[model samples]
Target: MISRFSNVNRAYVNTVGISSVFNIGDSMQITPSIKVLAIQREQEIYYDEEGKFSQFPIFEEEIPQPVFYEQLTTNFFNKNPKINVDSISVTSISSSAILQIGSTKDIVCESRTKHIRQSKN
Candidate 1:
């Protein structure tokens, strides 16, 4: 396979992320699994405020079950074969993205994110 890249300004990959893939000459197989639990708290205060801010509490029962178990037991990819690519050209690949130019047998990617946000004003 022939891959040509002209310019790549920036790439931001986070957590379980794949930024870019220029080229895969031969066959490629990838299996990636990720589970993330993120909690964020925000509080806004004014200049004329007087009293103190209350505490933020997180109870044990508020949490939920994990996300990896159910996904692990499932097979979501196709069982059919794929044709190979002859040539490819990419100008930019940014921000948790993927660019592949080749043949792939089985590619399974699983990502679960549980985000909890609390804001007080």
Candidate 2:
């Protein structure tokens, strides 16, 4: 049963030199899901009259870089010699299904919408 939808919340810049945040936990699935809750732009933050700001949609600017799950594994391992990641899952950007991430794979998503509304660069 899906509860809430939340996009992968982006955090600070990592060693790979990209901005990132923790994606919705693999185990969590809420129907009315909140895939991501990103902050709007600088000027819009001050003048958006629609109260859309209340929603606080995720902003592309806030997310400068998005390193894939595989990348994370390599980067994480390199930084902490003591830590060892084994498995990882990759998400399909075009899918609606929530992403499943492991220690050494990529995150994957089973998309709901057929036409990927998200802007792909």
Candidate number of the best lDDT = 1
* Residue pairs in collision within model 1: none
Residues 35-90, candidate 1, lDDT per residue (tens digit)?
A: 44455767553334422222223311244544674534444454443434444455
Alpha-carbon TM-score of each model against the true structure: 0.38, 0.18
Question: lDDT values of the candidates?
Answer: 0.44, 0.32
Q: Which ten residues in a row have the lowest lDDT in candidate 2?
A: 109-118
For residue 113, what is the lDDT in candidate 1?
A: 51
Clashes of each: 0, 39
Candidate 2 per-residue lDDT over residues 21-104, each given as its tens digit: 234333433222223333354343443554342344342224345567663332232333232234434433221333223122
